[model samples]
Target: MTQPQRDCVIAGGGPAGMMLGYLLARAGLAVTVVEKHADFFRDFRGDTVHPSTITLLAELGLREKFLALPVTQLCTLDAVVEGERMTLVDFGVLRAPDNFLVLAPQWDFLDFLAQEARTLPGFDLQMDTEAIGLLRAPLDQDAGREDAQGTDSAGDVLGLRVRSAGGDQQIHARLTVAADGRTSALREAAGLRAVESGVPIDVLWFSLPKPSEPPPATLAYVSSAGMVLTIDRGDTYQSGLIIKKGAFPAMQQTGITEFRTRLVAAAPVLAGVADTLTEWEQIKLLTVQINRLLRWHRPGFIAIGDAAHAMSPMFGVGVNYAIQDAVALANAITPQLRQGVVPERTLAGVQARRERPVKVMQAIQGRGHRVIARATVGQRVLSLGAVRLLRLGSPVLRRILARVVGVGLLPEHVRTPPGGSR
Candidate 1:
């Protein structure tokens, strides 16, 4: 069957794609989103919405909705290093309104976005549709003669032929967005190469028993091996074990008690809650690869979110960055489209507008991963230095740390809003 042509088609209904759909549709562009999964699961994915992203959410008219969600406000990140506990960073220094990270489940956020997108005028959310390949007919000027005669003369994107439960269907759009995640099929089809540099730390996400009593804001225990991020989720605390790439399985096999012991050895204060630990089978381990695609846009297609850049889990900033990309892409191109510019030309504006922020985020994530990967001696120095520097509360240090927490003082290019795309 043939799907109606749209102004834009976004593959992968993750945060970025959904937000992009909302933005474009709000701008009166017919947009359709294809997702392989029929249902949004409760995956333990990104939950940290940095202060920078908070600011962006306000710009998108989503602050009130996002704030209404059950979220934990993470004001500061405390680091326990070599038995010394210190508030290594405080997000409070960022500008008013959005001064800290908002901790909420990505599933809840995406679901809210999906619900919101349904009410928009020009939006279509197609679930259980999988993109198999890019449908590009080698620019044949002769082939589009029929389309040229039609009211929509630009011929734009012919969209994608996707596999679905019913059968095969062709989704037509002026632009196709790839938000299909780190290993993106659309990006692969576009022949976009990913340039990656491995970070020193890999993260293992494991679920422990939900604490009877709630936890602190956010905990970062930096050790010679790596760091563990105790991210606060309203109902449960998500513990991310950042360790050497090869260390997770061995640690998992050591069983709960031993794992608890090791965790306590690194940060004794968390030992009290160790007994609540449950199964590790559901634990998801991700190799920290700080990678970026050399090209974000190719012809009628553009990749967003993890599809374009997959950053290390060191600072929990990837989701926020992806949301920023959605906003940038939408803001830069919608007005251009409204003014009758061709889709390809409008996408160029999107690419140009997004280039700086992508680079800035890549650079920051790279440096952060390096700090996480520093040797024991180096980590000790870094930990102690961070403690000492933080104590000063100097203007420069405040500004720098604010940037680290995604409250970057750089122009709008570098600042992403804090709320999830609501």
Candidate 2:
């Protein structure tokens, strides 16, 4: 069967893929986004939409609509370390209008983008379709040999072979983006190598009913028992219990009641719902990973977000970084895409612009992993130094930390034109 052709074909409908698709479509470039999932409903996905992301939404004039969705604004990041409550990062100091981390389910955010993208004449979204491999045109063919600059090029990628409920099909495009996430099949098929950083901890995520009254803005608890992070989700608290890496299986052998007991002991705040966790099936394991590709692009394709770099969940910046990647990609490629050719240099430029921030953020997350590993092994207590710094250092220190988490090292902005609203 003859495959439909588009200006760009994006694999995976996560933040990176969907946002890039929306931006390209808005720029008047035909784009098709393929998602393996039929719907964007998933438990325990990154729900923290950082200030950086909020800024991008505003740039596209979708801030009000995006904020209309049910979301909780986290203005201050507090934590219970060694039984003492300490304010670590204060988002209130940021000068932006929405100077706080917006906690909304990732699905709502993606759905919002998908709906907005549909308004553009050039946008096409195919749900329940998974990209299986690349559709490569022979390099010898003159039509297939053109580079991003319309010059002769090697390693030309033509499109994607995708599978859906209907069956297998092909999608041809001038450019293909691998934004399918950390375990991207396309990245692997392209033989891009990613350097992995060993993580010493894993997270067990679960949810409990929210307390009738407002909970503390604090999101983390570090005690002799272990480390726990909780985000207030309006009606419930989404929680992550940090356990030693590779220890979950052994911990599971001990039984669910003991696990529940340990959870209550670690964070007394969760005692109310401790008993609600009667079965092990209620918990989901998130195997923490930190890694980045040495190279983020090839002749016909480029990888963004977790496809290029997978971050540790320590700071909940994974989603934020992915969104940033989308913005950078759009800013760099939209003009070329509009011209009907995307140079290999342009693809490499996207990676060059975004790599530094990825490196810096991953280093911070790596240090966090080491700290958590030490606490899990009882090798160290919650650093009183961190508490001292926050206490003695004026609001300046808090603001600095907040800026780091809220906006990241170098944030990207929307550069593409905003299309008509639906």
Candidate 3:
């Protein structure tokens, strides 16, 4: 049987793939997005939607509709470092109209995008389709062989070989995009290598019922017990307990009773509901990773978002970065895609445009990891002087921090044409 063809085949239907698919389809390109999961209901995914993303949605004329979904607005980030309460970032001071971050389940956000993309004429999203391998096309029949065996040859990725409920099949496309996230199968199949950094922390995520008198600000408490981050999730408070890398086994051995006590000591806000966690099954472990692919593109394939760079969950920038990548990809290749061809240069252009920001963010996350590791693993108390300095600093300093965390380093705009004919 003949395989189906498209202008672009995007492997993964997360933020990056879905946004890219929407932009391409809006510009009248036939886009097929394949997602391995049957649905987007997975828990513990990043839920912080930054201001940079909101601005892009506004430009696309979907901001109002997007914001209409059930979401909690977080206007500030406060942390209790060494028992000293200090405001770290204030989104209220940002110059942008939508200054605050939105706390909504990732599934709702993806579902909203999927619904919008479905309205377009040429967008096809395939759920339960797992991309297993790359379909490569030879570069030249008589190219000079580089290897001694003369078996190694240059080739371009033509599409993907995917497995679904029906059977395994091939998908042909003018361009193939690997947005399958940190453990990207397409990126691995294309032989792209990611340089990994030693992240000294991992997160244990769980949720508790919302308190009767909820705290006004999202809180990050760093104490002798451990570090804990709690975000208001309307009915429940989503929490992350940061522990030293490879400490989960010891934590498990310590048992749930001791774990609950440690959590309550770290963040007093959870004192009322921490007991709800009776077993290990209630918590999810997120192994933090900070890495980036040295080369984000190979021939006719391009890797974007977490597939290109896996970010640490320090500032909650993963989803925003992914969306930014989608916008960049759309801006760089929509015109070429309209011509029914995506040149290798275009794929390279996307990487060149987005790599610097990834490096900067990774560096910041690395520094943060070191700080947390010292406080948690080394048992050294964080200096209160930095907190005092931030509190005494000018409002401009707070705004700068806000722009860095809330809006990101280099924000991307929506350049692709809104719903229109080719």
How far off is model 1, as Cα RMSD?
6.1
Q: What's the TM-score of every candidate structure?
A: 0.85, 0.94, 0.95
State the local distance difference test value for candidate 1. Answer: 0.71
Error of 2 at 8 (Å): 0.7
Error of 1 at 296 (Å): 1.7
lDDT by residue (129-208, candidate 3, tens digit) is 89988889866866535433222336778998989999998999989999999999877777778899999889999988
Q: Candidate 2 has which clashing residue pairs, if any?
A: 148-342, 148-343
When 2 and 3 are scored with TM-score, the better candidate is 3
Output the worst ten-in-a-row residue range by lDDT, candidate 2: 144-153
| Winning model by TM-score | 3
> What is each predicted model's overall lDDT from 0 to 1?
0.71, 0.85, 0.86
Q: What value does the lDDT take at residue 413 in candidate 2?
A: 82
TM-score of 2: 0.94
